[model samples]
Target: MTTQNLLVELFVEELPPKALQKLGNAFANVLFDQLKVRGLTAADSVVTFFASPRRLAAHVTNVLERAADKDVLVKLMPVAVAIKDGKPTDALRKKLANEGRAHLADLWPNAVDGPDSLVVQSDGKADAVYLRGIAIGGTLQVGLEFALNEAIAKLPIPKVMSYQLETDCELPGWTSVNFVRPAHGLVALHGSTVVAVKALGLTAGNSTQGHRFEAVVSPVVLQDADSYAATLRKDGAVIASFAERKAEIARQLAAAAAKVGNGARPIEDEALLDEVTALVERPNVVICQFEEQFLGVPQECLILTMKANQKYFPLLDAAGKLTNKFLVVSNISPEDTIFVTGGNERVVRPRLADAKFFFDQDRKKTLASRVEGLGKVVYHNKLGTQGERVERVRAIAKAIASQLGDAQLVQDADLAAQLAKTDLVTDMVGEFPELQGIMGGYYALNDGLGETVANAIEDHYKPRFAGDALPRNTAGVVVALADKLETLVGMFGIGNLPTGDRDPFALRRHALGVIRMLVEKDLPLDLNALLAGAVPAFGDKITDASAQLADFIYDRLAGSLREQGYSAQEVDAVLALRPQRLALVEKQLAAVRAFAALPESPALAAANKRVGNILKKAEVEGPVDAHVNPELLQEKAEQDLFAALQRFVPEANAQFDAGDYTASLQTLAVLRAPVDAFFDDVMVNAEQLDVRMNRLGLLKMLHNAMNRVADLSRLAV
Candidate 1:
């Protein structure tokens, strides 16, 4: 088989900016994978993808012109029906005909003698025969067409557009096709020879349009697969590669920001950058400015409006504050820059004015004034209105604060929780839901509320995403934790538990938020107790899902701990205890890991496991006595182990009480030798009932001492 580089392009109308990259990647990868499946490319073949506002393209190297021939076994009907008198029968002929191998029907040989024979009956008779045949390879024309159709079918289109295409000479009427956008042209080249493939009612060709406005020719003809990118850059005046275009835009953004001096730089938002890159073909960054008075609004407001509405980059100063000047990525470069800059400035002024208007009007009333408005906003059909939800949150927060600190902290948390959702009705937040907590903080300050309360109101929604910062103070922490718990417990209570990927309320994220607060902040709250307290706040609207909620939180904690570099065995051992104080989980896990590394760890862990199994089996008759009768320690090994536990357990308990978990576990390591000996020589299930119960009691006492920090049995290999 001969091999060459392959290029494929699908030209269309403007694609959805947010979905362009995903669509391009899906198109390229699916096509490449299909080729590999069809034996047209090797596993090591390289594929490069290109995506812009108007096209999706892929360049694959080492693609074969024809897939190599292979021997494919095609099964025929079984023995009794396939052959008669050592010759093929009618049923086998029909099977071969259906497979397009009727001509080879007579060539099938006679059946052999035994189990390895081709002939064997269903009932153990020597009459069944199975025939097989080989299939030939496919050509590039057939394979490429199949791959193109399959790739298009698998494109991850956010929305599909239906359009009618003029029929080819062979088909006279119109044909309707659904795609991400209306298809305009397609280019598929295999080392300068156009692959015979058709898609979206168009035949494959070696030409495509580039930079609708800057192209030197209407349709720039690609000479070969290797010349596509360079030709598009030179004559078509377009950067065909998405990555190259993005990098170029970054370079221009930096250069434009630098021209302003004073340590100014473009706002760093990768999502915004990608979206802007997708909206342009030939990017030309132009510096524009708005009235400095607009900066009076919050920088977040200005930055969001500029990036979201105008698709511009707002430059920031050395202090990371938004400046008046911004950069625009223009698709065309005009000789007179004033027209372009002035036009952009004119277009953005109204957007800024709207943001400023919302800001000014939102400050007219105190957050407390918006409290009653929440009564009309339904939180959930079964969970009542936002006003009702606010009451629940306030109660949970107050209880948490009372536990964490004094009356002042409780009062502050109460006020913050009460006003947290008030901003949802504010003009600024209503216009931009992303500004909910931020707007509340600003309004609180304007109402003469102290910074502590203002910050609490703002940060109650902190750590909204993975790696996001937590609440700034104790009051904020209390309210934030309460809010997340209420959501989790309420959702789980009403049978709204998340199933698969359908968590409409982001319950998974809320669960993770709680875990992050508990483990990362090292909060002293009991996880089970928190859930228990939260369930009551929902009143009759929710069931007691406290137990289920705790399990969910622990599962999230286990996954999160593993992600942070703890091994599965280490995590299982620590979490097996279901320690109520999650803040100490990491410490316990650390101790477990340290203990597992000891020289005697393996023997001790196995013995611990053995002791646990014995206790479980012995408990079926009745509860095993925890009180070990020392007088019944008949064996020397048992006596030695009992003596070791009496001496070492207290020292370990003392270190554990002192918060030196590592020391506590290390102290227990001293009993490993005696534990091994006891399990080796002593029969825990003795002939005498009293002696057996006493031995079981000794094992129970040792198990309790060994597992205070972690379940050592879980560490056994």
Candidate 2:
């Protein structure tokens, strides 16, 4: 069969900007997959998708006009049941009738193994009667209709809208149509031929409208499948591809930024770019500006208002300071350009003014003044108000600070923690919740709080996401840790742990934040101790779930370590010890990796596992002592092992103390040979009770020495 390119387009009202890319991709992919499943796509078939505010379309290459016929096998029934005396039984004839092969009922007795024949074959368990037949090919019209319907049904529309078709008004009764948007037209072409298909009450055609106002023609007519994009662009005044349109917009934005001079550039926001791309069919970047006096507001406040409220890209100078200028991705281009730029500037003035007003109104009240309002705002019903949460955070912050720094640091941490959530009550934050912690810092400075305290208040929410920077100062670190810990402990204590993908509390993120601070900051705090200490702050409001919370944190750490390119074996070995000082985990992992590479690792690791198992069993019988009695070193292998441990363990301990973990593990490698000999020649469970205890003690000492850096047995294959 001959193959040709195919094109399909759905013309509709503007789609949701955030969901346009997904809808377009889903439409094209599902259509291509359905066609391939029906054998209408060639081996080399490929699909290209296009999406814009008003349309979603796909182009497929190497699609066949008709699928090729193929042989099919139909299993009837057991052979004995299908035939009687070499003649077809009634059951066999009935089965063939159901298969639409009733004419073969009489010919089956004389049938041979051919395209349309019946034969007896074993279907794994038993001999069965099979019908071999040739299936007819499907025409492009039929295949395209099915594929189109399937694609429509599968589009990832965020919400569907229901409306009455114009035709429905003329009928006896009204009929309603549901879709992401009201459908205006449908286009389906196989090569130059229009495929008969219908969707959303519209029949397939060769014509589609474009650029509601700028199109050279009212309806751009595509001549063939291969020329769809070019024809649309030439006559319709629209770019047909989402990616191409987005690239063009980026180029224009850059060019516009360059024209502004002073090393100006548009702030990079991919999500904003994508949303803008989805809002316009033809993009023209225009530079616009607001009054310079608006710069008195925090640049963050101004920048956010421009981007979030206006969907404009704020221009930043070489120093990353916001300039008065911004760029707008307009849907149309005018030759004069002045009206377009002036109109955008006029439109954005009120938005900037609102931000300035909120900022000015907010700075009137010091952050300390807002602290009382937090008591009225409910944080969580079970956790009481934000005021109560703040008090808990202050307690945790003071405790963490006392361990990490001097009294001044502690005071700063307490103050920062107290003020961190106060922004939630401000006018600016009430207007834009994303500016919560950010506004607090500004207000802190406005109150004449020292830069250190202001910085701490601002950065207490640092590292809010993955790869986000940690707190910039020690006080910030203390407060951030305390804030995150309070959330985690309170949520977990309330039996509100993250289950599967339903972490409404963002407990996973909070847990990861805690892990990042502890591990990356190399804080000297013990993980378990931190959790236990935070529990008292909750008083009767929570249970002591510190044990469960510790496991959660360690689990997060293990997953993070694996994602960072460490082997599962390496992570398991290091984390198995439940090392309290998370700062030492990285070093322990590195030491484990180094030890695993040694030639003696496999043997030593196996011996260590064996020793662990023996000691575990011995513990059930009584207690296993680490003190090895020289009198009980009767076996030559045991004596040699003890001598090896005596000779090399001290050096390993010293290296471990000095934080030279790799050296420590390497120094212990000397015991591998003696360890292997002891296991091979000595029986851990001796017939003599005293002798058995001594052997257990000897193994205990060896086990302790081997696992100081990591549980070496976990490295075993």
Candidate 3:
């Protein structure tokens, strides 16, 4: 069988920039998969996908014109049901007729082995009659048609648009077609031959429109499958491949930034780069500038405005300070870029001016005054207004700070927490909600509240997402913890827990944020105590759901640790203890891992599991005390185990107290021999009541000492 390269393209209106990359990949991948499924692709076939503002295309190598015929064996029915007295029954005849093989019913008796044959085989339950036949292969036109339909149906369209197709006079009526964009043309070629395929009411062709303005040709005619990208680039004035176009834009941005010289470079934002790449076919990087007065505004605000509003890249200096100069990725590459640069600069000046104006107007009223406005802004209907939420957060922050810091730290934390939501009412933040906490920080400094308070106000929302940085100062840490805990406790209290993937409040993110601050900051705060402390702030507004909230946080912590590459068993053992200080969890996991590697681990773990089971059963009768009577030690094995505990338990306890978890677990490793010997030689449930209780007590002591770091019983399997 001979194979040839294949090219398929869909020409349409501009696509959604944010979803273009994903849509392009999905389209090409689905097409290739459908081809492979239909056996239209060769074993060594490879596919390359292209995405641009106006089109999505794919080129596949080693594609076959038709799929080869395949030998197929299909189970018809059970042998007992199909054959009666060594002859075909009515049921078998009807089955053959329905399958369009009615002649096979007559040929079944004499023809036992051939291209079309019936054989008996067991289908794991009963013997079944199998129909062996050579399935006819599919032609390229039909296979390609199926593949095109499947690919179009499976595209990850963010939103679909419905448009009416223009009909010929013979057709007379309008037809509605839905797609991401109004598709104009579709190209499907097998080498130089056009494949008979249609999608979204358009027939396959060899020509497609290219760049809207700069194309040298109105419709670029592709000579062969391999010439798609080259022809588009030369005659159509378009770079067809999304990745190549993006890389070209980046290279030009770098070159333009270098020309501006002063150690300047474009702000690095992959999302913005991708969006800009999806908006243009051929990119022309142009440098534009604004007045330096806008620099007085926060760089974040200005940078965000330029990138988000204008899709421009703000240049940053060596010190990572935003510069007046910014780069624009334009679709048209005119010889003289002055008009383009001037137009972009003129357009951005008003946006920057608006940000500066909002900033200046916002600073006129200090954050303290804006605190009154938050009462009108709703945070949650059930929870309360932002004003009420602020008070709760302040109370929680004070409680947390009092435990971790001095009177000054508590005061700063309270101030920061009170003013944290005040900026939600500011004009700047109202316009750009992303700058809520950020604008508060600026207002704090403007009010002469000092850098400590300003930093806390800003950093209170730290770690807004995964891997984000935590608060910078002690006050910030205290306030951040309080803010996150208040949300978790309040939401869980009101029964607005996250179900499946629908977390409208982002409760999971809030829980992880709380866990990150507690564990990473290593605040000497007890998990239960912190949750309890947050409850009083809510008063009667929420139920005391601290117990459920603690479990939620621990679950989040366990998941996070596993993602960090610890095995499930290790995470389970450490988290099983529900260690109060999450900071110690990693160390505890490390210790558990070390102990599991010991030659004595398996036997010891098994013995520990056995002891736990025995203790559980003994406790059903009465509470078993850890106090073992030395005089009650009758068996030699029991005597030896008690002596070993006396020798090692003290040292292990000391290491545990000193925070050396690894050393402590290793110290207990020496008792494995004695423990195994005791389990092997002694009868735990003796006939005598005193003897049984004493044995249970000895096991209880062993269980307590072994589980200080982590429950070894979890490692038993």
Over 4 Å off in model 3, which ranges?
112-114
Which runs in model 2 stand beyond 4 Å of their true positions?
Answer: 80-91, 103-105, 108-114, 166-171
Query: Which of candidates 1 and 3 reaches a greater lDDT?
Result: 3
lDDT of 2 by residue, 1-717 (tens): 799999999999989999999999999999999999999999999999999999999999999988999988888899999889988899988888888777777886666535788877899999998888798889888988999999999888899899987564555665689899999999999999999798888999999997988899978999999998888889998998999999999999999999999999999999999999999999999888989999999999998888898899999999999999999998887788899998989999998899899988888888899899999999899999999999999999999999999999999999999999999998899999988788888899999988888888888887888999998899999999999999999998999888898999788888899988898889999999999999999999999899999999999999999999999999999999999999899999989988899998999999889889988987996778899889977899999998998999999999999999999999999887888888789988789988888888999998999998899999888
TM-score of each: 0.96, 0.97, 0.99
Instruction: Give lDDT tens digits, candidate 3, residues 1-717.
Output: 999999999999999999999988998999999999989998889999999999999999998998999999889999889999988999999987787676787876664545787778899999998888888889888988898888889999999999999775696899899999999999999999999798888899999998899999988899999999999999999999999999999999999999999999999999999999999999999989999999999998999899889999999999999999999999999999999989999999999999999999988888889889889988998988989999999999999999998999999999999998898888898889998788889889999999999999999988899989999999999988888888899999999899988999888898898888888888898899989988988889889988998898888898999999999999998999999998888889999999999998898888888889988887887899999999999999999999999999999999999999999999999998899899889999899989988988999999999999998999998
Better of 2 and 3 by TM-score: 3
Ranking by TM-score: 3, 2, 1
Candidate 1 accuracy as lDDT = 0.89
- Number of backbone collisions per candidate: 5, 0, 0
Q: Give the whole-model CA lDDT for all candidates, comma-separated.
A: 0.89, 0.91, 0.91
Q: What is the lDDT of residue 514 in candidate 3?
A: 83
